[model samples]
Target chain A: MEAGKRINVVTKILAANDRVADENRRRFAELGLKVVNLISSPGAGKTALLEATIGRIRKDRRVGVIVGDIATTKDAERIAKHDVPVVQITTESFGGSCHLEASTIRQALDEIPLKELDLLFVENVGNLVCPAEFDLGEQAKVSMLSVTEGEDKPLKYPLAFQVANLVILSKVDLVPHLRVDMEALRANVRQMNPKVRTLELSSQTGEGFDAWIEWLKKP
Target chain B: MHEASIAQNVIESVLRLIADGTVQGKVARVYLKVGKLTAVVPDNLQFMFGVLAEEGPLAGVKLEIEEVPIRVRCKACEEAFEMHEEIRLICPKCGSADTRFETGRELLIDAVEVD
Candidate 1:
């Protein structure tokens, strides 16, 4: 007989990931809880944005956070200062996994009292690359890029920008000092993601935060 | 960093297939069709699979990853060719940015062979 070859297995992998992601999304929908997956490069102010947003919204909405980091509970520690339920998933526990998997998120969900919360924010590990590829069962995925990070970031890392429903331009307070062209950044973002809502705000001064809060409040 | 997590997804899927009578034990190889535009690092995925599978049901299964390059067809000239990264959308033949991407965003388990 001619040499018999083995069948390929890539389809099985993606199908399984999609099925689990769908299951997780369905569960979130059932709870009527809007889960937001927050992604960005390190120091893009993901934690700061979370703190500010949580401080603004937590008064009316029950907010919970699952923070992912490579090491230390630094981000989780900062988020815990806001007095909301927080869980930290270190990469070390999962053999240095950069993004939270559906199974991991499912376990984290078990830790949270879903009925008691209106929104669950998963602050994904601060890397623009790997986190964008995996879906964490979120109702919306928000990519945080700082003004200091430059405008070309979205064009360079197109996948992250393309997958996000919203792109928050964090640390706008530094815009005056930095040379970031806000208009060009917005244009590039619009080119990559036409429908992605862009918000420019400073977590420190609280500028443009109201619109962000209102955006999150909308159904 | 998330490569291992993605590999875990692959392993989980293969196991489910086995449980559902899709495949048998002792998988020889797993083939993946990954697109360049998908941003998945194939080496990281293979490394992840190797590490995770050492203790799982997919133990000893070989990983085969193939890259699928993006191709675009120009709206103006109807020219189809492989996309060059330096020039994202402009058609090389006609130098028009009005083109629709044909491929390069697939992430799928094409097939698996098991004992």
Candidate 2:
């Protein structure tokens, strides 16, 4: 009986992206590589941290990097000086998607020497809200939160806080000057997701970076 | 705004429904279940839906968004509750900070209503 044109269907809005994320996961699994998605708001020190992280780990670990920006090879350029295989996926054609989708990563994966690296870091475009939504099939989604962004950031952008496996509070050296309440920031992050591990560091001063390097130590 | 892509996703889902041929006639509304945790703003989604869901069978389709509150549970005491504010995460009884999300952080088209 066509009494009413009623159709009941359940759909996942990210089904397409999730499918690509799954494929990327399988690809990374086959290559036996650990991929970490480095997400942050713009100017949160993602590139700087990567440059520092790669420098510290390159002696022992074969690391590769992929940089995604709305439009720029500047990050890729910065990582190249570290003598690693880095590719830049500029999303100018994709209407400047603020996040890195699995499909974007898939296209850039071909140029990366998957078999030659122990760890791969995908520095996603700097936006807390959008990048938190797209999963690039990384082993962990790590976000960098700087002190200047304020303590209420996690509460205001809870999705970024909730989804991140780990959150690194960057630019701690500026905390004294910026009046960033570290405890309040930690409380906000814990309230959003108590399970998220956090670390406070200053890349410029090289403070609290040993633990960062230690966390990435090959297991 | 990513709503442009999100609106496209809604249309794709609706198209798939029509392709399945289970429901008859035109699509009147697309019901979306947006968790409070997702960053998709309702207004943006609505505007994008209006713009992107304009071609073919999805033209002039309505989007009904149901926002779900963020729910969490204490890992230490198994306290299942929703927080009005994100700063207060302590278990009222146990006072433990060990808590995890039990819900929220979801964005899905739960069920679409067809005309």
Top model number, DockQ: 2
Candidate 2 stretches with Cα past 4 Å from truth are: A1-3, B21-24, B75-79, B85-88
Instruction: Report the CAPRI category for model 1.
Output: acceptable
DockQ, per model, reads: 0.45, 0.56
List TM-scores of chain B, every candidate: 0.82, 0.83
Write candidate 1's Cα lDDT for B1-115 as tens digits.
Answer: 5566678778877777778777765678888887777777899899989988997777788888989987767789998888546214556688665666677777778888665
> Model 1's DockQ?
0.45
By lDDT, the best candidate is 2
Model 2 residue B56 distance off true place after TM-score fit, in angstroms: 3.7
Candidate 2 lDDT, B46-108, residue by residue in tens? 997897766667878788898888777778888788765553556666878787666676678
